[model samples]
Target: MSVESTETNPLRALSPQDLRAHAAEALTRARERSVALTSVDDEDLVRQHSKLMSPLVWDLAHIGSQEELWLVRDVGGREALRPDIDDIYDAFQHARADRPALPLLGPEEARKYVREVREKSFDILETVPLQGRRLTEDAFAFGMITQHEQQHDETMLATHQLRKGDPVLHAPAPPSSRSGPLPAEVFVPGGAFTMGTSAEPWALDNERPAHEVAVEAFFIDTAPVTCGAYAEFLDSGGYEDPRWWSERGWAYRSEHGIDAPRFWKREQDGWWRTRFGVYEKVPAAEPVVHVSFHEAEAYAAWAGRRLPTEPEWEKAARFDPATGRSRRFPWGDEEPTPDHANLGQRHLRPAEVGAYPAGVSPLGVHQLIGDVWEWTSSGFEAYPGFAAFPYKEYSEVFFGGDYRILRGGSFGTDAAAIRGTFRNWDHPIRRQIFSGFRCARDARPSEVA
Candidate 1:
């Protein structure tokens, strides 16, 4: 295991040659990380580190194995590697960490395997020209795979740190705090906003077949629910009270034994949270992040609030009354700036809510654009007359399922990828991403029924 080039920025435009070179470099690093696993005693490799970190051996194989499956095997190429590769390394398709162990390669041999596959993937990438007919497909596949690996690398780093009993990670600086409430509640006079994307730059199929959506009036929380506020829900026994939960949500909560948010631990002196292996006092004013849809819904119920629907979120964010049109972003058509929202810090962590008040939408909602992803009441379903986008797996797999909509980008979100029209989805119970929620209310007088 050795360090060569540690360049992790794989999203920038690259020539065919550069793309190949970068892929090979990343594969080499993946191998090195894997080889490092071999040096760990078998007992240590198999030990449970933490939920945030997987076993090193599992991570190493999963990274390479997933690349081959998604990019090569799924894309019509034969699986050219070990037949049992999926059995050994598929994290999503398979969850058992203790699959029949392969003849574990010594560090050097494993490195060679990683290097070889990486080279092959790179070589294959070169065949698709930067501006060719297959450009969209190649970009989407490579970009998604690249993103997956990058996330695994971060996870591996966390795993290593946790195994060594390191401290939790905090943001480099505390996010700017806001006192009290917003200046005034933002009322996005609701109307039709075009929902979803039609543009061809690396979007999942589910985000495609762009369509216009009619939304009625609704009032959204000016800021994400703060930790201080959620604390009130907890103090009121929100978790124990079943009336606040949907039947499915109640079941999920019981299955997981969830009480407070996932990372929270009540201590002798109030609440503390663990992040990236370290534990720190939970900041009262920071947005209460990492809460599942179930948890968010439950909290909202207890607080006499409701989650906003997707159109309601967009109306508050991108709608401009003068034009009666939605801008690409909440602030305007211009690209995101730090002052507008929190994003793309190399270290992944969300800023305090309302830190970027200037970026508030026309409706005066703060952090409507970025911070932690805000859960909406809407589900992940296609709009009327939705057709599949080019990337078939992106939207086809999850349509009409239980996944929920999360608007606003997160701290880790790619700047180029975010827009008011962009939509993200996840299972309602999953809360690993930096996610939070804001409250909403029916704005129509007749909604009182």
Candidate 2:
């Protein structure tokens, strides 16, 4: 919350009503997420779906407690609604595997809690002006909370995928691939481009202090590596080949006995994938998901290429050669819509690579904003002059090589939590997350545009 740049306010220009509306919509989305996955009995909600994720009940109340912490107590200057229960919802205090043992609010009580918090948060939304403090500036705290909830929504969705119960959630299948020949790779004539955001109102602290980076010209997959391409790799023993993998990646692959992407099963005819308990033939045209950073890197090496660095990914996603400027999204500064990206849990799976032509980046990199979180080669690190705002846990503490950065976002990610510069990170061995990658290779001098 320190003094920032002399940038004009992105939120101050917004009317109080617009802020209220945005806040309300976020709350509604939170509720929908709750209802969508937690519709089952209380036992199911309380049961830990995976060792890596908390029970549904914990996520529900945690979402409410966060809203209350930031909006009600911090912004509204109101007293705590239930200070005694704060310890129960403290995420840092308990790991996911240990959360089920804690005394948690049941599904009914958790729902009531979020509803009450939402009402009070709306009251604060009406009166709170766009203040200059980095926490409150540009209505960032509100934006942060919205993004937090939406992010948890994605986490809960992943948890649901791990459950063994009957399918409860549903969505229409993604649109089929557009009929045409798709280029295997697209050339990017890279140069210095602005990388991150300085003035975006809702942008998180990690994506700040926009800086310039010079990347060498390279070629990248026109879209994500498809299931068909990955199946070919698996058939060719990509897992068995040590030459294609890094030291750490090869170790993980051997220890886990991972021969193919998660959720894939070998059938007599072909590979079958389980999506929310429904078994079907793996869609070859769609991007292969549920693979870890190690798998992505291995795939890149196998293809005689490499994973794009975070800067390269950003360049391909945001850099505009004609204008020599970076846009807020792949398309432009405009907010996302159904036609633009496959976000907000609209589809249960990724659309085929050729889909979302409108959402392509300036250089014709398709589906850069959504489908699967595209894994990058860079480790998580802070930009130059990066400052922690609101709290350190949001970004500061995790700045190191342990976590690899993932750009774009998955089909389950909400519009609130994504932008061109927005980043997501995780351990290289974790494949439960919806992730995929495209390859990159150094461009020849003549290939540079």
Candidate 3:
């Protein structure tokens, strides 16, 4: 069997028998991982590595609180395990910078509290039939909880990256793509393709109410823009040139004195990046990671291309000309395996481009599912006929022009949390989170095949 599952019905785990097994395994896996990752010493766990991130201990408790809130209380109608901590763990109630100052559970105490919550969540999972109620129909709540835990795990890993210390986490290097030179770009035929999911069993509220978007034919990079490519932008003074940037982006770049991707610096010989405590020469072939949406847009403009719009991105990543249905992932309906993409923290960094030939989109776009969260040209907004589910806090509140949309998962993103239509958004200036981009160009009438 594969290390990770081929989640045919990714959200609910497919059949009732499978749902029971999957849910039990998923819940246990999440719990074990939560404990394992928080095992860092007490001070480090509670310390806020970056202003943008919550302390490691907070995430540990928050995951447990969320599981209990959703699975234990909402689905099973159980009493709150600890109602007092609700506000402390409530993501919206407090900002990340303020979290460490709030009264929080210590590492050991957090482990104990979460384990007890896990016991009750298991009780609910074992007894609850996968039927009735919108939340339970496809076991959506359990899937949501699993994805939620995984998302936080990734965030905690990012915190580790920002910490000032020797490496606390390490993994074997990614498998070599061993791919030599390859095509620069692939042409995606123009037309209307379904852009969102209506039937995806585990899709979030933001991805609901499937709609068709008409996109003109365009050319997209075969692989993500690599560090080598980004270096040219830096060398050519891409940042110094205002022509490549929007007025706002230029202002942010100039105000912050930003000149290169975050975490990058020149070390005599060439550009070097520090990732997860290991400082090394930037891998020229690896897809560039940790760039912001604004930096990505500037790079695209420098290359005489623009970031692909959300629909154009989806069509390239999901649409298959031979089949009229959109696939759950870039590769197909099956869930992720190591051979398909670098996901679930299996690799400490992204694989070199062209490594995952099996993970390419039907239109031949490489690395569309992983390596880095690719920036898009769209703003965060609801789809036509969109409706928030279970709660509006999940997606409805964040809808607006203030946030830009990013597609595809990064190397640290878990398989359970990402798909072809999965949507992630953040303010344009934030770059600490794993992010990168690919360039696209409008296909002229003569360029269409």
Candidate 4:
């Protein structure tokens, strides 16, 4: 199915005018990200030595190609703009490491091509009926394209992080405060709550068909595990101890010789980390980031705790006991504000753990929506009644044990693309993305009392 079968829902019927506005905003955001990802010089855009990420130029043109396929060809019923270049831009067709070797478009050519495609997309949007047909109905295809571009924007941001160069991007630091101390952990009084979204208009397929999940009461860290906390783990020989790691995690750690988070190095006096091409002493209060699922799990085990299950993470972030409903964000139904969370690339690093009291959940869990994508102890899988929409590759192909679910959005995540129900998945061993975790534990009878 191309769209969720929700015909009776009026909210899905986004007006043509509104859809046009959204399309324009999304394109503008994508363009801004493109500029952020590449330098003025051509060499930076074409450089593709990083095996983990795509060349910035390829990502630029691929965004345009996706828009053309969905908006121009599918929704507008128009002819292809560059049919011959389709295979080259197809993500599944080529691995990231092999992309640079391919005859991809140059920076200038890519910029021009994307500009032309976006112009056509806008032309189609002005006239196309925003109703009828799964693809065109409620302008789902346009919304999908917008979200797709934003996802690529986040990917390009990751590429920027991977590239070795002076920092090309800058943003004001997140607000800092001396907010008296917070509890070490908060109790998530559990019962049944909707685990996914059935009513959110733009929610993807995997997050559809809201289902009830019952979780036992648990205690979750009020703030994410911090650098100081993780340092304690490392100092206690956490990495060398096999008991703290899963069999696969131990194997991966031993093979890679990983003793701490990626981008971290030891110095004569203390630990340091690289952030946005600048190296500095690790901030003790900020959430430890660039950690993989394995590292998070190992750290939890070392601390005598465990990663929260995906449902537990969602319950903590979105569930409201008063209304018996899940709000669109941790701060309520309103769109994210700067006071709410550290997002939209507003900062190069996460805010201090206890900083965003305004963004705290009803249960007093802080920074649940934005800061870092929190690793959960759940495999990526389709919810019951889930159906593939538009394409199987989006979510269907990745349903398995190989990938893990990470809830919430990172500091680099675009506010437009993130919601309470948004689910991000990556291989367990992958650490390049901004990832961290909070510890959770079963609430014993005495603790609850």
- Residue 216's lDDT within candidate 4 is 94
What local lDDT score does residue 358 receive in model 3, on the 0 to 100 scale? Answer: 86
C-alpha local distance difference test of each model: 0.66, 0.86, 0.87, 0.85
lDDT per residue as tens, model 4, 1-449: 11123222343454668667776776677667766666546887898738999888999899999988888888888989899899999999999999999999899889889888888888988898776677776667776787788888878878778878777778887777446677899888868887787776667888887887889999999999999899999888898899999999999999999989999998987899888788899998999999999999999988889999999999898877776777777778777888899888888899998788888888788999778999999999999999999899999999995999998998888877788889999999999999999999999988764
* lDDT, residue 426, candidate 1: 77
Off by over 4 Å in 3: 1-13
User: In terms of TM-score, how similar is model 4 to the real structure?
Assistant: 0.95
Candidate 2 residue lDDT tens string, 21-56 = 776787677668766777778888999989999999
Tens digit per residue, CA lDDT, model 1, 1-449: 00012111233446666755655554454445445434565655655566544566566566667667765665437556755556656454544444334444433444455566666676666664544445333355665566556555545544544564444333475357554456534555555766655543444555565567787777678788889889888988888999999999999999889999877899989889877667788887778888999999998888777999887887787666666655667777566777788864333456676677657676567887666788998988876667664445657777779889998877655454466777888789976667898898767776423
- Once fitted onto the true fold, the runs of candidate 2 whose alpha carbons sit more than 4 angstroms away are 1-13
Number of the candidate with higher lDDT, 3 or 4: 3
RMSD over all Cα atoms, model 2: 2.7
Model 4 residue 279 lDDT score: 88
lDDT digits (tens) for residues 192-302 of candidate 3 = 777787777878999987777888999999999999999999999898999999999999999999989999999899999999888999999999988888899999999
Candidate 4 residue pairs in backbone clash: none
Who wins the TM-score comparison?
Answer: 3
- The TM-score of predicted model 2 comes to 0.96
Error of 4 at 177 (Å): 3.6
**TM-score for every candidate vs. truth?**
0.75, 0.96, 0.96, 0.95
Which portions of model 4 miss their true places by more than 4 Å? 1-15
